[model samples]
Target: MKFLLVEDNLDLANAVTSRMLMDGHVVDHAEKIEDAKLFSDTGEYDLILLDIMLPDGDGRSFLEHHRAKKRDTPVIVLTARSQVSDRISLLDLGADDYMTKPFDHAELQARVRAVLRRNHGSSQPVISVGDVSFDPVAGQMRVKGTPVKLRNRELRLFELLINAPNQIFSKQKLCDRLFTFDEDVSENAIEVYIGRLRKHLEPSSVTITTHRGLGYKLDPR
Candidate 1:
């Protein structure tokens, strides 16, 4: 998962970023609201770890601005503000979760995972489609309880397909959603990954079919 962390406390920022990185997440940090806004405008992150007290502005205001644009990206407010009213207001303003200062590191990590899972429409740590079961956190796949080795891109493509099961994802849309915004890749890369994933999964009845001129759809039967 990719996270954009907006916190002005440099020491806290470094600690959070380092911990998340060690836990295998890609993290980007911003010290001010302006930089956070810019990052949000341009990046596709799974979650935004926002601090209500920033150098430039209140994070609540920033969340309001982001919501105005109809961006549904989940946010977890990490702040020293522990007021019940503050938490209520932030949630009312659309924050997915909130964590107070001096939080337990394990709790923070679990909340991040829980929020991401909820955003994906599930709380199950492993998603199953037909004979395939995928563990998003561990990045592991099992077919009929047998471990199946998959390349990184292949796993991501398969995960998207499995999550939506039977829905069509256009090649361009798949490309846009599968990779990070800054990655210099193309829709053809998506096609290649799909093709590779098909070779491994199709025979197992988790078929990825082309809609031709439209895009690809995965049918787990």
Candidate 2:
């Protein structure tokens, strides 16, 4: 999943960003409310981890504006406020969940999965594409009940494809989703990853098809 992490503390932001990346999710970090708004304007994130106390403005205002625009993207607010009223207020502001500061990384990850599952209306963690099954939360893939050995890049590519099967992903979109803001990716990096993933899925009923001048889509063979 792609996420926008709106945090002002460099230490907390880096820690969360590292853990999310390790979990095979693309993340963009913003230190101020203005920066967060800029990233949110792109409409590329599946989720947003918002810190209530931001440099430019409080997160509640952002959430209020976002919901007013009818954006359904799920938001998990991170704040130090432990009052019940505060939590309720955040929810009323359209936050899907709330996590207090000094929270565990594992707990945060689990909450992220829960929120995403609810958004996608999935009762289980595994998303299946024909005989190919992918667990985004577990960062694992299996073909016909057998585990498939894949490199990190290959797994990331497959995850994106399986999550939105049949949707065409352009080369530029793939590159932007796979690489972080600081990482330097080659022009053909996405092509190489797609080539590898295709071979890995060859034995399964799932197929990745190129759309000539367009892009690629995954479908059941």
Candidate 3:
């Protein structure tokens, strides 16, 4: 899954990004409200972790504007405010969930999953493509009831393909979702990752097929 993190504190942002990276999720970080808006405008994010106090302005206004535009992307507010009224106001402003600062990474991740599950209306988050089953929250895959070990990059590629089994994903689109803002991705990065993911899915009935001029899709054979 791809996430947009609106945070200004370098240390905190790095810690959170690192933790989520370990779970095989792509995270994009923005330090200011303007940059946050730019990221939101250009791409579709699975979820956004927004800090209440940004360098440019209050994120509440951003949330208000985002909701006003009918953008239903789930937002989890990160704030230092602990007052009940503050929490209530944030919720009223269209935050899906709010987490006070100085938070435990585990709890924060749990809340993120819970919010995503609620947003997608799934109680048990499991996605399937043929005999391959993936738990999005845990970032784990199982083939025929047996767990398969995958490198993070391979797992990320498979996750994208499995989530939209029949839909074609262009190389550019995959690169956008797979790499972050600062990474130096080679021209053949997407192709290489796709090749790696195909080998991992060999034991399962699912196969990723190229669409010639279009791109690629996961085909269940």
Candidate 4:
């Protein structure tokens, strides 16, 4: 999953980002409210990990602003304030979940997955496209019940396509979704990954089709 982390604490932010990367998630970060708003405005993240105390503004206000604009991306508030009232207020103001400071990295990761799963309408752990199945949490794919070995880039492209099947996504959109802010890669890289994915899923029951003027989509025909 791709996440946007909004925290002004540089040390904490780096630690969290590193752990998330180790766990195979793409993470982008913004240290202030304005930077966070800029990233949120783009509407790219599957979830937002927000800190209540930012440099320019409070996180709750940011949440209220985004909620008013109808941004439904799941948000998990990370704050030093661990009081019951604070938690209640955060949830009441439209935050999806809450985690306190100095948290267990594993618990935070689990919370991220839980929020994403609840938002995406995924009943089963595995998402199926034709005979192929993908596990979003584990980043695993199976073809006809046989495990398929996919390169990291190919897996990321397939994950994005399968998660939102039938939704046509342009190459640029795919790049933003699959890579983190710090990772520098070319737009042509998406095409290369897609081409490799087609070869990997070859002779399979599923198909990834290109829409002439639009982009590419996964069709389970």
Candidate 5:
């Protein structure tokens, strides 16, 4: 998953970003509401981790403006406030969830998964496509219950494809989801990852189909 982490605290941001990366997520960090707005407008993120206390402006106003635009992207607020009223106010403003500071990393990850699962309308933690199964939390893939060793990029590509089986994903979209803002990635890189994934999945019942001029789709073989 791709995430936009709007946090001004350098230590906290780095800690959360590192953990998210370890969990197989691409993250963009912004220190101010202005920077967060820019990143939100320019990139596609599965979720937003917003901090209420930003250097330039509070995240409450940001959430208000974002919701006013009718953007339905899920937002999980990171706040130091412990008051129920504060959390309620943020939720009313459009935050999907809130994590008070001094939170458990495991709990935060679980909340993230729960929110994502709710957003995707899936109750299962492991998404399976034919004989291929993927555990997003563990960042593990299995084919016919046997572990499938894949490169990091391959795993990410497979996860994206399997999560939305049969949905056509354009090369550009895949590139955007797989690479970070500073990474120099091209459409050819996407193809390379796809090719590698195809080879790994050849023995399984799932296959990736090229849509010619369109892009690619994952389907049952």
Candidate 6:
């Protein structure tokens, strides 16, 4: 999952970025509302972790504008405001969830998964195509109930594919999701990861097929 973290505090942002990176999710951090707005306009993110008291502006305005634009990417507000009214207001403004400051990382992770699951409209947490199954929260992929050893990027590529079975993803789209906005990618980087993932799934019925011009899709063979 790619995330837009609209946080100003360097310590919190670093911790969050490191945690998400360890979980194989790409993160683009912004320290101010201006920067967050730029990222919001330019990047496609699975979720947004917003801080209400930003350096430049309140996050409520950002949320309002985000919803005004009709982008349904789930958002989880991270703030120090703990009042029930605050939570209600934020939820009414389109926050998928809320986390008070000084929260546990585990709890935050669980909330993220819960929100994503609800947004994706899937009550089931694990997603599978053929023999390949992935638990997005656990960041684990198993083939025939046996865990497969995959590198972070390889797992990310496969996770993206398995989540939406048989959906064609253009190379640009895969690149956008797999790599961060600042990372330099070669023309064939997606191909390289696809090749690596193919080897891992070779024993299973899941296969990554390429369309000459349109890009790649994962389907059961």
Best by TM-score: 3
In terms of lDDT, model 5 sits at 0.88
Decoy 1 TM-score against native: 0.72
**Per-model RMSD to reference:** 3.7, 1.8, 1.4, 1.9, 2.1, 1.8
Clashes in candidate 4: how many? 0
TM-score against native, each model: 0.72, 0.91, 0.94, 0.91, 0.88, 0.91
Candidate 3, superposed: residue stretches over 4 Å from native: none
Clashing residue pairs in candidate 5 (N, C-alpha, C atoms within 3 angstroms)? none
Tens-digit lDDT track for model 5 on 22-75? 777888888988888888887888899999998887899889878887889999
Clashes of 2: 0
Best by lDDT: 6
After superposing candidate 1, which stretches have Cα over 4 Å from the reference?
A: 1-4, 7-46, 67-72, 83-85, 101-106, 118-126
Cα deviation at 196, candidate 1, in Å, is 3.3
Candidate 6 regions exceeding 4 Å error are none
Tell me how far the alpha carbon of residue 28 in candidate 1 is from the true structure, in angstroms, after superposition: 6.2
lDDT (CA) for every model shown? 0.82, 0.87, 0.88, 0.86, 0.88, 0.88
**How well does candidate 4 score on lDDT at residue 210?**
88
Report the Cα lDDT for residue 42, model 4. Answer: 76
Clashing pairs in 4: none
lDDT of 3: 0.88
